[model samples]
Target chain A: MLQFAAIILLMLGLYGLLTQRNVIKIIISLNILEIGLNLFIISVGYFEGGLAPIFTSETPANPNFVDPLPQALVLTAIVIGVGTTALGLALARKIYQKYGTLNLDEMGEN
Target chain B: MLDNIEVLQVLEIVIAVFMVVLAFLAINSKSLIKAVMFLSALSMLSVIGFVVMQAPDVAVTEAVIGSGLVTSLFVFTLLATKKVGVK
Candidate 1:
């Protein structure tokens, strides 16, 4: 079910990317795509009643943990996602300044 | 698992569904501010889903960075453009 949601989110983002002409909208689509990817990665490492990978004295002996590797990858992905989002928004602002309009159709290819 | 469907599973399903629906609305919304707001809401919803999936680290990071910081950044950018500045 989680995978299904992820796939749907990717589809929605892709559709937005292809159809939307607004710069902010395009950035938003990219964000949705990243969110879906992160969700899918975490879902792959999840299982019923698995323990979180945090180790401490409070944890029990012989703890059954879900894959910690995917969580790490997702952490990196989320950070990269933030960086990319900021970059995209910056580019959007530059585009707005260049064309005096956020709509790509209005700007055209000059 | 089929023999006993847990409430947590049911809740997970509901959150995932809401996440997908919000993604749709956020991407396709007509207003830019509205889209950003929808995305913020979706991020918070995903944090809940992350906790349910046993990813506490991701949930904490997402709640702080994804939902809060990113939303504020987007709003700031929008305001800077003066296209939808304070009226």
Candidate 2:
């Protein structure tokens, strides 16, 4: 269920990227894309009757823990996503300063 | 009596639908700040969705990092831009 939802979110993000004219809007679309990607990746680790990978005193002889590998990878990916978003926003600010407008059309050959 | 699993399943659907709706709204919003707000809301929903899917670690990280940090970055960028006064 979540897998499909993530896919739909991805498609929406892509649509925004293709159609949006503003630099900020495009960056927002990139964010949407990353969120959807993370969701999809994390959803892969889910399973019925699964608990978090953390272990504590409440152990029941054996336990079904969701895949920790994907979770860890997603943690790293989230940090990277933040870094890239910051970079994009910085570039956007520069674009605005240099071009005096964020609209792609306005920036064209001006 | 609904079992915990059943409730979570329902939650999964609700979060997914809300995520999609919010994503759509975030991108399509007329005002840039409104779009940023929608993106933050979507991030918050993703945190809940992660928790539902048995991902406490990611949920905690997302709750802290995704919504607040990203929104602030966006808002700051908007602040620096000329002719686009915060509205």
Candidate 3:
């Protein structure tokens, strides 16, 4: 079910990226695409009654835990998303400074 | 193995639908600030979805960075552009 939603989000992001004229809106669409991927990965690892994949003396020796690999991977992806977003925004700032406009078609041509 | 699968599945479906709506609105919004706010709201909903999917760690990270940091960064950029004195 969540996978279905993720697919929808991916398409929505693609639509925005293709249709939006503003640079910032394109960035937002890319972020939405990242989030959809993250959600899909997490959902793939989920199981009913799954505990967090943490080990401690207090924790029982045997327990069902959700797959931790996807969580770790998503963490890395989230940080990377932040970095890319900052870079994109910086480029947008530079573009605005150069062209005084954020619209895709209006930048650098005039 | 939840006994009440129907209710939980229905709730998840509803949340997912709302998330799609928020994403659509965020992309379509005219004001950049409002669009960023809707993006934050979408992340918040995803945080809930993560928790419901049994990933609390991801939920925490999403709440902190997605809802908190990203929104602030976008706002800062918007503000920087809006203030003519800065440029």
Candidate closest to the true structure, highest TM-score? 2
| Residue-wise C-alpha lDDT for candidate 2, range B4-65, written one tens digit per residue | 88988888899899999999998998888889989999999999978877889998888888
Best by DockQ: 2
Candidate lDDT scores, in order, read 0.86, 0.88, 0.86
Worst lDDT window (10 residues) for model 1 chain B? B78-87
lDDT of 3 by residue, A1-110 (tens): 77778778888899999999888899999989988889999988987667778776777778788899999999999999999999999998898788787887866674
Considering just the first chain, candidate 1 attains a TM-score of 0.93
Query: How does each model score on TM-score?
Result: 0.93, 0.95, 0.90
User: Stretches of candidate 1 above 4 Å error?
Assistant: B1-5, B85-87
How does chain B of model 2 score on TM-score? Answer: 0.89
Ranked by DockQ, the better of candidates 2 and 3 is 2
* Model 2 DockQ (Cα-based): 0.80
**Model 1, span A1-110: residue lDDT tens:** 77778878888889989998888888888888888888889989988888888998988989988888888998899989999899888888898788888888899695
- Candidate 3 regions exceeding 4 Å error are A55-61, A108-110, B1-7, B83-87
Candidate 3 chain A, poorest ten consecutive residues by summed lDDT: A101-110
- Give the alpha carbon lDDT tens digit for every residue of B15-57 in model 1: 8899988998998788889899999999998888788878999
lDDT of 3 by residue, B1-87 (tens): 565666668878988998999999999988888899899999999898888787888899999998899999898988877832221
What is the clash count for each candidate, in the order shown? 0, 0, 0
RMSD of each: 2.5, 1.8, 3.1
